[model samples]
Target: MSKGQQWDVVSGVGITALAVAAARAVETGRPDALIEDPYARGFVGAARAPVKLPTTPAEAEAADGRGYWAQVSTYIAVRTRAFDDYFRQAAEAGVTQAVLLASGLDTRAFRLPWPERTVVYEIDQPLVLDFKLTVLREHGATAGGVHRPVGADLREDWPAALEAAGFDRARPTAWLAEGLLPYLPSEAEESLFHEIHRLSAPGSRLAVEAIGNIPGALADTAANGSVRTLGVDLADLIHTGQRPAPADRLTNLGWNVRTVPATETAAEHGRPLSPAFVERDARYVFADRPPRAIASSAMSSVIRPPV
Candidate 1:
């Protein structure tokens, strides 16, 4: 991994910036909040330089200081909170091992309290992991349980990288695909999860998030933001084996699947979104891996701490 520098490359800087902004919004106490992530504040402090806002005046203006970026930040914040709640609830339900794929700027392993022997693995590009490590060390933040940082790309030989870093696939895992899929190519995602299913043991759990309908009718506000639709096919991003059906999707691929709504989870967790946000239909989901049907463990995925 590159030495301590930028943790987020790709559009991840945008995503990380959104995550940071969302953390700020949630801390500010928005009424439509889905979950609370107090730890997000630290990532702002971790930055050694000022963040570069978007180039165009409209984009820049909307990106920050309470405009378009503010709206994007709020959506990202609510999503973060809901996903955190999902993982936390999954942990409480007894899932042990966790691997956070593309663990960009996420602080879950440190902020989330876990079972005594819980082990967390974080996978991301080398430089990304290195940057996070530097910030976390400076801030004196540590992983809640046994934490391992596996610096590698999901599109590469991350499986070997993880195994070298002490990942044990036999344990039940709670997988998190938060704020990552949209950046990847459709073909890469298939290879990615094919490995995930291959390495996953029985009783593993999976939680996923992805880009939603960006058509104006779906979310007019979302269209005004710096975000892009990720321009990938839904079937590849959602399910490769099952067609379009949610209930039968994961089951066809060896896991029990349930699609949870961002709006619903928000309300259930006491953070109600405005009707406008719901009408936008930003996509998010929660799924659990059932016991392996055909046994052939291939590889799983990473986790990260606050920067």
Candidate 2:
């Protein structure tokens, strides 16, 4: 990916962000869908990118054909539902301040019925944020709570930008880093977690989609097949280098952590495991920072549970 300062709908890693929206739009149309994003289809239509969203069963069949796209759709569906539930659970626990890092065409800020006094800060590229808000406004969709769009790159001084956008770092915050890790280099990924830990107050929570190692042949098929079919090569955009374990890092940072495999998440949601399961290395992680008293207590044991 180019290190350009600007990107629109179809260019660079920004296209992959739209690609995820396309997947979500397809999933929302399914009768037994795991999650629903009412704004996803609109974003797809508005984008200049040739992002294909399967609106009919035949179109879906032709697009997937029991191959890479099929698995990609299934994985995204499961991932979307899991993260949706994570935010809802976090919000219910009275954590009002929320931030969606690398938020690309995500409609949770407008869709989720949040509690009073809730504020959601969405951080993403300037063009990405502008395009999303423009499309959303054209569709006449209203936000569910306070939605703050902080236009800044993750590699830049984003924390300062987020604070300037009215983010209160002093309060307990719920942070979502969905579909962000793989694109970052190993060192940058480390820096991202460290920054998150630095800004997090006691009782803060985090949700992540951790990337794992995939088998060689399966990876090759996905790189060739899924990439061309979707008009976005996620494999090419992502870094395959070894990354520090997210759960381990969070645990060492004095956070209570839980990790779950995508396969288990699929089974729990009654979705079929992707046929390319052998090649896909994906896991969901949830971490919570304990309150001051709990962190100081000797009985503070990290809670590890399968989602």
Question: What TM-score goes with each of the models?
Answer: 0.72, 0.90
Q: Could you report the Cα RMSD, in angstroms, for every candidate shown?
A: 10.4, 5.9
Model 1 scores worst on lDDT over the 10 consecutive residues at: 231-240
Q: Report the Cα lDDT for residue 23, model 2.
A: 76
Supply every candidate's count of residue pairs whose N, Cα or C atoms clash at under 3 angstroms.
12, 0
Model 1 lDDT per residue over 1-307, tens place: 1223234533333335334433443344545444444444455445433343332224434455545544444556667777777778878988778898877767778778877688889888776676667767777887887888888777667789988988788887788777666545555666667777877877887777744543432235334433332221222222122123323445667676777777766666565665556765656666667654543343321333346
Q: How well does model 2 score by local distance difference test?
A: 0.80
For this target, which candidate reaches the highest TM-score against the unseen true structure?
Answer: 2
Query: Clashing residue pairs in candidate 2, if any?
Result: none
